[model samples]
Structure formats: C-alpha cells, structure tokens
Target chain A: MSGLSKKQESLIKSLYTRHGRKKHNLCICEGLRCCYEVLNLNPQLVEIAVCSEDFDLSTLPAVASEINFIRVPQEKMKSFSSTVASQGVLVVAAKPEFSKSDDAPADPYIFVLDRVMDPGNFGTILRTAKSVGLTELWFTAGSVDAFNDKVIRSAMGAQFGMTLREFSDLDVLAEELRRFGYNRIFRTTPHEGESCFTAPDLFEKTAIIIGNEANGAAELDGSLSLTIPMPGNYESINAAQAATVILFEYVRRSEGGA
Target chain B: MSGLSKKQESLIKSLYTRHGRKKHNLCICEGLRCCYEVLNLNPQLVEIAVCSEDFDLSTLPAVASEINFIRVPQEKMKSFSSTVASQGVLVVAAKPEFSKSDDAPADPYIFVLDRVMDPGNFGTILRTAKSVGLTELWFTAGSVDAFNDKVIRSAMGAQFGMTLREFSDLDVLAEELRRFGYNRIFRTTPHEGESCFTAPDLFEKTAIIIGNEANGAAELDGSLSLTIPMPGNYESINAAQAATVILFEYVRRSEGGA
Candidate 1:
C-alpha cells in the first residue's frame, strides 16, 4: 500500500477551497462514483487516485492503471473526504478546458446560469443538462464554483462529460451568444412572456438562462423572456427544478413530441 | 415579549424527531418564508408561532394575531432550530389531514413517492408537485417522513398547500389508486417503457411514481413504466429533477402544448 506524503496531503486539503483549486488548476472528485467517472470518462485529466485499504481496486476502470494510486487507512481517507460518510475513494484531476473560440456551432442549445449560488442546485443543473445531451454549459461569474465539493458530489460526475465556461457579465455573454448564431435567447420568469410550451422555435439555436435561487435571472438585453405557466399558488419552483423542466421540454420537442 | 415555557421548549426540541411529530400530531415550520406560508395558506393548522425578539411581527399576516405567539432571544431560538441559521421564526402546527375516503375524483393526478429517502429530494418534489397544480401527494410508508425538518426547509412551505397521505405497502397503494380511478399508473426507469412525452393519455387519471435515490421504484403489479430519455452517458438524473421534468410535462400537455 502506498502512503500519501505530507506535501500530497496538504495539496488535497487545499482543493476544498475555490482559490486553492484555481491555484493548482485541479479539482477533487470524491466518492466511489465520482472517482470512477473521472477515471472512466476523462482519464486524461486525472492526476491521482486515492482509495482506502478496503476499496476494491479491481472495480476501477482499466484506465486507472495509468494514474498514480495511493492507498491509506480508512480513517486517513475519511480526513480528506468532504462528505459525512466517505465512499473510500477520491480523485484529483485537472479541470477540463472548454473551448473559447469565436466559432459558433450550426445548432446551439446552451444553458446559461446567471448567479446560481446554491451548490446543490448548480450541480443538479449540470446533471440535467448532461442528461438532455447538452455538451457545454455557461455560467455567470457569481454562480457557485463548478468544482465546489458539494456541487461535484451532487453532479455525480456529470462534470466530466460537460464543457463548462464562465462569463463575467450577462451583457457580454449576450453579445457572444448572438455572435455564435444563437438567435433565441430565453430567460424564464415566474409569470410573464409566452408559455415555454407554446414558444415558437424554442429549440433552434437557443440559449436558455436559469437564474439564482432567491432572485430570478439578471436582465439581459434582447433576450426573450418565457414563463413555465405555474398554475399553483406558489410563486415559483426552485431554480434547479425549473431548469430540469425546461431542458426536458427541449428533449421532448427535439424528439418530435407535441 | 413572552418567553417559551420549559414544557414548550421541550416540545419544540422533540418535534425535530419523527416519533415526536407523530405523537404530537404536529410538525415544525421554520424560516420566514415557511412560517409565512403556513400562516397564510393554512392558518387553522397553526397552533403556536414562535419567533426571536428581533423578528418583526408587523410583517406577518393578519392571521398571526389569532395564533399563540411566543418570543425569545435570538440565541435561545437558535438552540431550538434545526437549521444553521433560523430565519428568526418557527411555527408548530397540526399535520394537515388529507381525505381517506373511497370516492374517486373526476380527474386525478397523483405523485406516488416510493422509498424516497433524501429529504431535499422529497421537498423539491413537493414544491414541483404544488407548482404544477397538484393538490395532494401519496407516499409509500418506507419513504422519508413528509414533515422532516430538512424536507420542510427545502420544500419552502409547499406542504401547507399539499394533501399528504401514506400507504404501508405498494400493493395496497396500487389497489387504492385503481379504486380511485387512476387507470394509468406510471413509474420511471433509467431507460425503458414508453418515452414520457409520447405516452398516450398520461395526464388523465394518472399516478406517477417517484422512486428512491439509490433503488428505483418499488414494483407494483399492472403499473405502466415510462422513461425520460437521456442522450448523455450518465446513468440517470436525481429523483427530484426527474420528477420535475415528468410533472411539468403534465402541465405542458394540459395547457395544449406538446
């Protein structure tokens, strides 16, 4: 069994913070499932794989062989874990670099998260976006760090399959979207604008904006606002739930339903 | 300002547990939004309202005057709080009594949660169900308690507007659903059965089952299965996200959209 050096331990601990992750250009993927995903889907980004003595190495993917592996006592592994109950495995990997080129794809369907602060909500959005076949996600600067431990855990390794980009300003993002041939920029309101279901050409070259938990989306110039048509008395659903509903609507429409 | 009695303090602490909630036939509604909701939507259920000295009574609804109001120091209120930061207010109220009679409604849309263990997921599902105009939800006995503190917080007081009921067994629930004219019983799989969007007559007299986070739905005889198609490599989205997508589809279709 390999032991973690003091320097390695320090590095792993630092990854819990956004500043540290940015400094090292690495993020921690904790739990067995997340570690497996980082190793299986994007093995090239993985720098180190650490597991407790009881964790079965045979269960890991074949690509895990190429990565540096560290084995330690269960108690030691738990110290490095962010979750209350560690799954006995963790991985440190370089953050994926999404393309920032000016070229726009023929059919762009993007999810732009504007100041979504909740880690769980952000993570669920990433997971939902991936499930609906989205390749990339754009976030405003104020949104929670994509690599936050809680976000990563809730995302369930959906991050490995997604290209995440961040923008400092909504107007800048709007300008860029238009440049990329995204003709329809949709933002959801509690009750305003056209109903999402009845909105014409919703799936074609679209960029949908999901806002923060406490506040709706930040105002973007030239963006078409749409509502989910909440018939119930409550003001609105949570941001993550709202995002999932809208994304799946795209899926439904793309599949020739309705 | 009225201080909490020793008996009242003990009761408030005990309400944190499921057994205590059952024994007292009451649940705690914490935070400003939730307290506001319980008071506004279902004031009759409110037995006692407790607040920190700093909480402004003027902001509360006119109905607040009818309930027993107790005031305590912020530090004292924090001691009884289940959350890290109490929004300075809490409400102890009787659990809403949903109808148990045999009569079938003319048109019914029910959410059947089977062993959903995550409080956050349960709460989000409740919020989504309410947003889509659902008046009630049914749960299999093994599911997490509807009145769990985390569930209440995450649900953002949607419980006040919802009729919650429980069935000890999936079979009994299925039989009851049939008796209630729920002809189309749908449970989601990762990828199987009919696509949720294309499922014919999905919204008419339907009971959609949301399963546990780890294990899928409990098998019920004669229930039709449906899936939200995921083109991504991930196995599945979280239970709450999946439920929202499916429920909103009901909203979309009912509003004459695909």
Candidate 2:
C-alpha cells in the first residue's frame, strides 16, 4: 500500500481500457514470460510492476535493471490485473508506434485483420502470421485493439516486433495497399471460395483478410476469397485456426516451388 | 424455488469433474449451441436441462422430444454450470464409445494427441482434425479431458462426431496402433525434423503426434517427427495452430495433385 500510490494505481488500471491506453500512449504486459519478452526486446519499455515481497528483480534478465520499475504487494497486482490469471509481473511500455516504412517491399504479403473481436484469437493470429514471416500487419478500426493486455499475452511478443497499421476504413486501405503493389487482397470465407490447395499463382504479392469471430469478414468489392477445404460437417473452426491454415498455405505455395 | 430439486442440481454439477463424469459415464454439454449440437448428433443423448421460463422446447429439433429432459429456473441453471459465461442450456450425453472396427482400412491417417493440456487448444485440434477428414483421434494420458466444458465449446461440436480413444500409456497405444496396421507414427516437433513442405510419401497410413503446450511430445522410440519451417526468430507457435498447419499440409500433399 505504501509503495504504489493511488495515482499510480489508477494510471495502471486505466491502461486496460482503449481510451486510457490511447490517451496515455502506454501498453501493459502481464505475466513473467511476457514481461521477460518485453525486456528482451527492449522496445520503448517504460517501467515494470512486480510484487514487492515475492518477486526478485535480479532473477530477470540483466536488461531489466536498466529500466524504471515499481514493486507492489501481491494483492495490488491482482487488483490491477485485467486478466483472470496474473503472473505477478506487469510491464508498462510505450506502445510500439505504427507508420509506413520506406524500405517495405513493393509487393509484400501483408495480413489485413477485419474486426477480429476476441483478444486471444487476435493474438494467436499475430503469432502465427509472424511465425510464417509476415513482416507487416494491418487491421480495420472495428477489430480488437492490438495493444490490449490479453492480446499481448497470447501474441507472445510478436506485437513488439511486427510493423502494424491501423485503418479507419478498409476500402481506402485496400486501395492504398494495392497502389503500393500489394496485388491480391483475398478475404477468407468459410465457403464459396477456391480451395487453397489447388489455387494457382499464390506467390504474387498478397494481403490475406482474416475476419471477425462470429460474423466473418465484411464484403470487400472486387476482392478474391479463399477457403480451407473442410471434409467434415463441423460448423466452423476457430478464427485463429482458420487464419493459421491460410497463412501457412500462402507460405507453402510461395516457397514450395509450386 | 422448488422448480429444480436439490438432487438434480447436484447431479448436474457433479458432471463437471472428471471423476464424476467417469463414474456416471456421462458428459456435460454447456451453452445453447453445444446443447443443440448434442441433440442433432444424437450420440447417446441422455437428457437436456433448460431454463424453465425463457427456454422454448419447440425451438429445438424434433428429435429433442425423443430424449429425456428437465427444466430448471435460470438461477438453478447458473449454479449447475461450470463456465464463467453459461448460456442457460446444458445437455447430458453418454461418453462416446471408442472401438477399432474389424473392417477398418489397412492404412488410416490418425491424430495422436500426446498430453495437450489447454482446453481451448485441445478443442481447436479436434475441430481441425475433423475438418481434414481424420476420423480416429487418440489422446495419451495426462491430456485434458476431451469432454471438458471449455474443450466442448472450443471444439464447436466435433467431439460429438469423432472417434476418440484415451490411453493410459502412449507407448502401449503406439504399439497397438502399429499392430492394427497404422504404418507411420510421426511425432510433431519444433526442430531437426523433416519439413512438411518437401516431405515425401505423406499419404501413407500415418498418425501425426501433437505435443503438449509447454513441453513437446514425449520422445517415442522409432517414431518419425515433422517440423513446420519457421523463418522467424520466435520460440514456437501455439500447439493447436501448429497442429492445424500440419494437418492441412497432409491434406494438400495427398489431394492437391501438385
């Protein structure tokens, strides 16, 4: 109670909300593993909050000593944590800034996430896309905030490394990316699309659109679509699972010498 | 207050635990959607529990009328539910019986889940396995129970349609499957394994082993391992996401005709 003041506590709590995160320009990373990743990446890290009695800062990486941090009681960490489970370590960092890069490839393969509401699904998609070597990620306005704590936990630090772009209108963003030489913007659909296994010319510059959890993607005029051929009668797979299949298919087609 | 007897409430809650489910030889299906799936699948559906006031029995399929059911007040339903967000509908069904048919084909591609713990990840693997035309699913001991409420929700009803077998010891299970004519047992690993993209003879009677969340699969002597080539520096992808990529790759290789 004496270590973290009421003002600091309120500030930490505010970061859980989109409005507060935007106003303060901060992102909160919880759990020891994720905090370790943030410290290792060393990307605009502000401070780390830890349980005063139980947590030993020396156990963390050497870079952790270079950053500003605070120690609070275990109960305080629990009270401020947005997740159901807290790992007693929370890192406050300035959100990685988003901007168009000059060195970005002319015909890059980007991922356009459309209104993916679930934080876990959004985070998994980020991790999967990054694993497949996707350098750039874009999202529509309605999707979950990329910096949300749950998303950061699920993403496992890909959010820190990838170049991210947020757009208010997808129609405008599609046109801009197409002009920048992103040739294909394929909206993933559960049906009425070409099978990814047999689709031709998959090596071209592409932007695969991953949709919302329940509603799927918004209709984008003139855009192509792709489907993972499902042999069973199950209604649908999870959004993250679907995105993983599509992203890997892109990689397979591009690199398999097909 | 008298709508749902105390006996019924306790009975429903008991199914939440693995011991209770095993003793009763039943599984609990939570949420309206999952309950509907259980009714439609008609896989030994025992009974359905509904909120007394708001639930309309007629909205369910005609086959629902053929099953035993009970109606309880909304609060009673809440008390019996295991999930944080209960949908006020629960169904009790017999545990799906597992057996290898005598007429089974010589070469069958199976998914051997070795100690996958996360319910959400386990469920996603089930749905993906089913989507890719895999009918036989085997789980080694120490994995999360397949009928768990979280697994049931994430699986989106795949559990109702698949043939699931739980084995106490994986070594024994592997030997049995081998004797049953499963020629290849490929354990999925993160490194130093055959690349799925260029791997030959993928269509053979194969069983892909997906490992645990934290630790990879237990090393099985003489089992082949397959790796998904990752171009990034990230540690690894989610267990279910990795499994999905691998499952779809098998589909692509065997059927794509590339």
Candidate 3:
C-alpha cells in the first residue's frame, strides 16, 4: 500500500528490494482488476492493503482464516503504492508458486512470446491472450518477466490460474506436444504466404510464435511459419497484438470456426 | 517530463492532463521501444534525457544534430518520470496531428472502436489495426480519448501520419460508409453465427464494430443488430484482439485466394 507519507515511503522502498519482498514472500497488486481477480482466483491471500478510503471490500472473497485487513492509513497509503490514484485497494499476498506441471491445463491453449521487451505490450497481450481461450502461457529468449508488476496487472489475474513456462528452447516440450498431436507451429509476419485466419485449420495442436518488437524472428529452426493477414501501410503488428490474433485464431478454429 | 525534486510533482501531474500536455504541446514516451521507435521514425524529437553519468546516445539517429543532452540531475529527473530507473531519454514533441481529411488514400481500410477503456489494449489495437490495413480510425462516443497519454503511449506512434475521428456515432457513419460502397459489417462474440476465420468473405466494403471492455455494445443502442462470429471460449476475445482478427480476415479474402 502507498500513502503520502515518509513512513510509507520507507516501507515501499523496502518493498522494492527483492530480499525484503522475498522475506515476506508477498508482493503488491495496485490496480483494481489485478487485485480483484487474484482475490477471486486465489483463496490463499494472507493480507490486503487498501490506500483509498472509498474502497469497498465486502465483496472480496473471505480472507484466509488468520488474516486481518489494513486500513488505507489516510494520506500515508499513496506513498506505498505506485498508481497515481491507488484505485481504492492495494494488496500484499504471498506469491503463488508458478509451476508448469501444475498450472498447465490438461489441454492447453497457450501463448508463446519471444524476446518481447515492452512491459505494456507484454501486459496487453496477456489480457488479450486470456480472453481468447488461452489457459497457459510461456516466454523465452529474453522476454519480459511475467511476474514484473506491469505484466501482473495487465494479465488481470489470467496468469493466476494458468501455468507459466520459461526456457530458452522447448524442444523436449515441443516433442511432447507433438506426441500429443499438438505441434502445428505458426509464426506471425506481414509478409506473404499463409494468413493467420487460416491458422486454426493447420493444427488442433498449435503453437503461435510472436517475436521481438523490432526483430521479426531470429530463426525458425524447428517451427512452421505463418503470417497474419495484413494489407496495410505498416509492415507488422506489435508483438503482443500479433500473438493475440494468432492465439485467438486457433481458439476460434477449435470452437468450430467462429 | 517527471522527475523527483521538491517540485517535479507538478510536472509529473502534467502528464495526466491533455490540456497541460497541449499547453506545453509535448508528450512523453516512457518505455524503450516508445523511445527507440521515436528515434527510428525521426518524428521531430526535441531532446533525449539520459540519467547516468556514463550513459551514451551515440548510436541513436542523427547524433550529429545535437540532441539537447542532459545527464540527469538524477533525483529531479527520476521524480519527473514514470519508470523505476530512468532510461534518460523522454522524447518531447508537439503531439502529432491526424488531419482526418486531406489527400487521404482513395479507399481506406479502417477500424472503429466504440469505447475501449484500457489504454494498453487501445494501443495494441491501434498497432494491430495499422498492420492489418486499418489506416484510418474512429472512436465512437463511449471510447476513451484517443490522445490521452495512456492511449498515445500505448499506440507507440502508430498514429503517426494517420487520421483519427473522435466521438462519432456508428449509425451515422455506417450509413455514410454505405454510400461509399462499404456495406459489409461484422461483429464478434463467443456464441454467434459464423466462425471469425471462415465467415463473411471479405473482398468488398467492410466495417467492423468492436465494443468496449465490458458489456460490449450494450451502451451503444442498436449496434447489436450486427451479426457476430462466435469463438471457442464462452468469453469473447478481448475487444482489440477481436478487431485485429476480424480485420485481417478481410485482407485474406482480398488477396484473391493467394
């Protein structure tokens, strides 16, 4: 939580340090939706901090048995939080263990992003990816951390119930997916050839690859290539948007052609 | 423009205001790509603020032109910006103008949003819309201000050299588009008529209506008369992603089955 106070400043600065946050094993969620969604999805919240007096908490899920709530502490709370207005609630919860084995669904529709650097893009893609029937997500080769504050807020807790995978190469996983008959790979570009709308037809088992914002692709070493259908002045879509379109195309296809 | 000081608070606050930003006629791009792309696009940048004493701007465009360089008076600059650590460069420029009417292209591939509240999603949509032939954009009554700081930063300058219409009504515009021979209209939903991928052969005139984040098209009277393409999940694609996929389908059809 943040407030307009010196004490709040010290607490927040302390929270910024990994050792401090890790010791508590808790991080903050400042935005409304991220905080609310996490509360809805995870029944393990230890405590919550609300900085704005106008916040209504009666609707939130029951807190863990021993937990108690903290008041916004008036002008002091804003200093502990990042968003300008604080959105009425700021939460501190023990970070959930993100396990690929546990969180990855029985049949997963996942988003695979590579070297995507923009936090906002990363966040927006998560929001979009989730809306499109994606229940799992992975990042590789220098993509921004999903736990990064902006990503967590942007994902709207979509990540809360999903498995997140991080690795440089997923040859083993790809092979496994292939064995499960889920390995039709698609790459996005504005260049000619296969259009993304047709992507759903290629595989019930599919992986959509979106590259860095600036560099389209480093190598397609072991992936099938596809491009979104673009007919415009710009040559490419931003990484997140491209990923969202392809992922949804697969979902739409799986839904029997939406 | 924000940095910490006894006084940079007002400067940071200025960022949240359209009038204040316009009075100064300058806006800031906080992220790496927003800065790099501004340099790559060469859009009349006034200066690049570098914070560290050892920071270098040598490889950026037109280093010869003498960018108004400043090694951050560190404390004040950090107070003036949004990011945790200042990248040092916040390009300040007169907000670009979208003429709306000019030597506009003969026929425009455009996407219109009714009211998308999320700035990041709005930006991603603009980015994707641009990539997929939407060179002109219109925001209907419920839409957030397109030039608001969040939206602009989100757009990543995709609006550079393009036109935008604000507070317009789809009913009036759709009627006008019909006069121009753009009669095809498509809507997106999770339970609906065709699959977004294969339906509505997109060779002719088309206008896609993407509703807001919540209760899409509910606020806009009569827009629901339009047919929607249903997809896999019970939930629909995020509005922006829905727009991107639907717009691209048009492009695929126009390509003569290539």
- DockQ for every prediction shown: 0.79, 0.63, 0.40
Question: Model 1: per-residue lDDT, tens digit, A1-258?
Answer: 458989889999999999999899999999977877777778898877789988887777887777778989999999999888999999988888776566454335778899999999999999888878888888899999999988988887778877787889788888888888886899888888888888988878889898877888898778888888887767689999889988888888878886
Tens-digit lDDT track of model 3 for A30-140: 666677677767747534555456656665555522344455554656665556665666666667777645333454534567778877667777767666555566677
Instruction: Arrange candidates by TM-score, descending.
Output: 1, 2, 3
Candidate 2 has a TM-score of: 0.91
Q: Indicate which candidate wins on lDDT.
A: 1
Best candidate, DockQ = 1
Chain B TM-score of candidate number 3:
0.76
Descending-DockQ candidate ranking: 1, 2, 3
Give candidate 1 misplaced runs (Cα > 4 Å).
Answer: A103-107, B103-107
Fraction of native contacts under 8 Å reproduced by each candidate: 0.84, 0.70, 0.65
The worst-scoring run of ten residues by lDDT in candidate 1 chain A lies at A99-108
